[model samples]
Target: MIELPPTILQIILNFSIGLIVTVSLNIEVGFLNLPQFGRLLAVLSGAIVAAAVPGRILAASMGLPWDANYAYHLYNFGIVAKINNMLSENPGLSIGILVFTLVIVALIGGLIGYLSAYPALRLKEAYLGITLLAFGELLMNVAWNYDPLVGGTMGVWVVDPFRFVGAGGARFTFAALFIFFIAIAIYIYAELLARSPFGRTLKAVRDAEVAASVYGKDIVKIRTQTLIVGGSIAAIAGALWAFFTGSMKAATYTRLTWTFWPWAFMMLGGIGNNLGVLFGVFLYTVSRTAIILYKGTLSAVIPIDPEWLEYIMIGLVLVAVVLFRPQGIIPERPTLTLPEHKIEMISKKFNREEK
Candidate 1:
């Protein structure tokens, strides 16, 4: 048995990954009303960049063949070892590279977001969702066949900048900062956005595009901005995951892991509710982790494969939640965007109606 403590820590690390994914998705679908089914595309951008960009940078710095070819892939692994040795010898460079990687990842992610908006500009919400999903699938196909992006199926060892902390401390330290600090910071930003006048405009557009336009809200701009911000955040989250795992495999960033699960989380945790998002993520993450962790123990008792059992249980929970609790665990509370006087007027009218 792999000791409960390490397993639990691993689960928490993965939970933070899911938490960031779900929250970013919530910004797209729940808050902004963009049905971003192709969110995986934005995320994969981070992974691809993580593999292709940073590796090239390190390779060039160390006076190696950093070109796009089989020769490069064959020798890059050795070069990476040297880079690690250098990082170990110079702690300052190690930390600096990690920070630099994250910064570059954010910029690349933002660029992906900017590009992802083109499809949304002309398509209706439903069509836009389908188009986005198709685009993601298309990108995956290309990446898999193209050796340069990430060695096709062979994948690549992503930069693990946290090596300075040693193996055990690295993951724990990253997980703590991301889950508690980064995730919470993003949540607060989302909440603040939701309560602002701008957030009210997003709701207006979401509720009725025609009405929003009539009232002077730029529907197109709002939607595009949402996609840009949401997609960028999603990419950073995905890239951070790649760095954490210390590898970049295209298949690992599949629709099921980064896309579908987040949709389920957003729905299960009341849409437009950040607190609800966190709770929903916790519930599903724990359940799924428990199933995977105890699979062997479970197989000894039950004949069915634990993998199959896990999927079945997840599907059942999703269906049950959708059918019985559509509004999610914490039902969305309506945003109070009106001015005090306007709110008072509405209250007075309701009181008058009762009398």
Candidate 2:
């Protein structure tokens, strides 16, 4: 097996998380027509809740000191005396705690979804974005003030699941597996939601709310439902991210870091198509990772920092897509109309949506 550089490995993980976030965003904004500026709020809430719960669960499971037990292990690795002391003292808090911790992360996603309905009141696109952005900032601010939540700026250390299992490189391996499962599940569910009756309703509302409402659709309830579903998926991504990183920090979930890039991915690929969103995620991830990896090469040739260049390229792409291909590279597909049972001459525009 060819071993990837550690930086490459980190990039892969980051890219996966970005893709997941983008897909979730597309489901909400592109399909359901929800105006979400604070998408990171759900992600952060899920991740933090997962981190918080799993640490405690692991502690409770193995009869250990919870978060402190992992610390003890870290110290124990540094010195034989500490190892023997911890073994002699705690004696049995092992890998099971890590598994328990991951479960907490999954549950955290559900919890965020459950709470998302409360914030469903803000429905306007720009307003929602501002609210979400504010929420992300608020989380960081809270972390700064409450040091114990994520160890303040220094950040908290989490038990590496693979490390607990005595595997040298399993951390990335497992993280990849975990992320793959999440992506697959999210893709499947989003697709289902896109194709279902409810999904159609969501699209109708997105395309023209007034028309949908006139045709016996409850806009508020549908929007709320979409928020709950999409937020839940995002929360799941957040939880998986927290576990994969084995550390959660306010900085990780900030607006610039988390929210903006993912949404850009969705826009770049195609707004309403699930596959398009996934493609967007892939494009963003590959391009972003490639630039960062070969930053020196670019800077030597071009007079801009790789980071700035990355943003510039992304912005330019967004502009090109908007002006030339506003529908997106693939474009939002027209909803299909099911055929009637009888052989009636059905040439009445056949529009799936009412508007």
Candidate 3:
């Protein structure tokens, strides 16, 4: 059997993660006109919930005490190990846990979205963005200091479904496949929504809120719906992150990692174009992964620190993209709502009189 290079496997994993988050971020900033700078809030909800819930659920099932303290937290880790052993013996339990975790992640994510709309959505974009950013950081701080939330600063280990797989490469390969398929499913949904009437309303709202409101569209309703959907999708990334790393840390969901990079992916890909997200995420994730993987080798060839070199390169690439192709690699295309036949007939009618 041929094995994938670690770097290539890592790139695929990062791509899967970037795909979902970038696509969802597009829905809010591009489609909904909500510049959600704190978009990491939904993602944090997923990782935090994923950390606290499953461990507690499995613990309760095993009659282990679930409490707010370091001792119980250690006991919980033991329970997770015991559960992992049981899952190895019983595959059914593992499958159930996997499905249950994802569904709950979506629900909690949607709730975060619903709540976010209240405070920030009504404000102007500049203020709204700041509000959302603050909220995200505030929750992350709470999670970091609050032990019951996610074992506090110590973090919590999640029982990955792949634990039974045993082989490290096999586990990563399986996760990559899982993430790829899930990303595909999300892509299809985004494409369909981008072409639908509801999507048109969002575009209208994004273009001009006052104009859309004049046309009887409820601005609040549209924004709220967009947040709920986008948040739910983005949350999946956090759950997958937990599964991928086999643990959750509040620091892991920091604004820089979860929020900024996704915004970069969305902007570089074309703000309003879902298809552009695929290209953007691939380029960023692969290039970023390659840079990290070769940091040691590259440092030997250059006088600068590896970290500074990476930032310089990334900054240069971003500046070049902004200067050369401000609309991104694939600029946002006009939405087509007309039927194919109708469009063709209209074109023929226009040409017939001239001919």
29-122 per-residue lDDT for model 1 (tens digits): 8877788899898888877877777767877887866777522457657766766666656668766776677678777767777777888888
lDDT of 2 by residue, 1-355 (tens): 2345676666667667776787778878898766677777778877776555545454455455545433333432233223323323332443354445445544555455545555666446676667657766786688655655555655555444444333346547655655776687778878877778888888888878899999999977786677667676777777778767667666767776667777777777899888888788777777777888888898999998888897788889988987988767777877564546332435344543444
Look at candidate 3 and give me any clashing residue pairs: none
Instruction: Kindly list the per-residue Cα lDDT of model 3 for residues 247-333, writing each as its tens digit.
Output: 887887889878887887877888889989899999888777767887888778987887777667667767777798877888998
Q: What TM-score goes with each of the models?
A: 0.88, 0.80, 0.92
Q: Answer with 1 or 3, whichever has the higher lDDT.
A: 3
Give, for candidate 2, the lowest lDDT window spanning 10 residues: 75-84
Question: Top model by TM-score, which number?
Answer: 3
If ranked by lDDT, best first, what sequence of candidates would result?
A: 3, 1, 2
Q: Give the candidate number with the greatest lDDT.
A: 3
Angstrom error of the Cα, residue 49, model 1: value is: 1.0
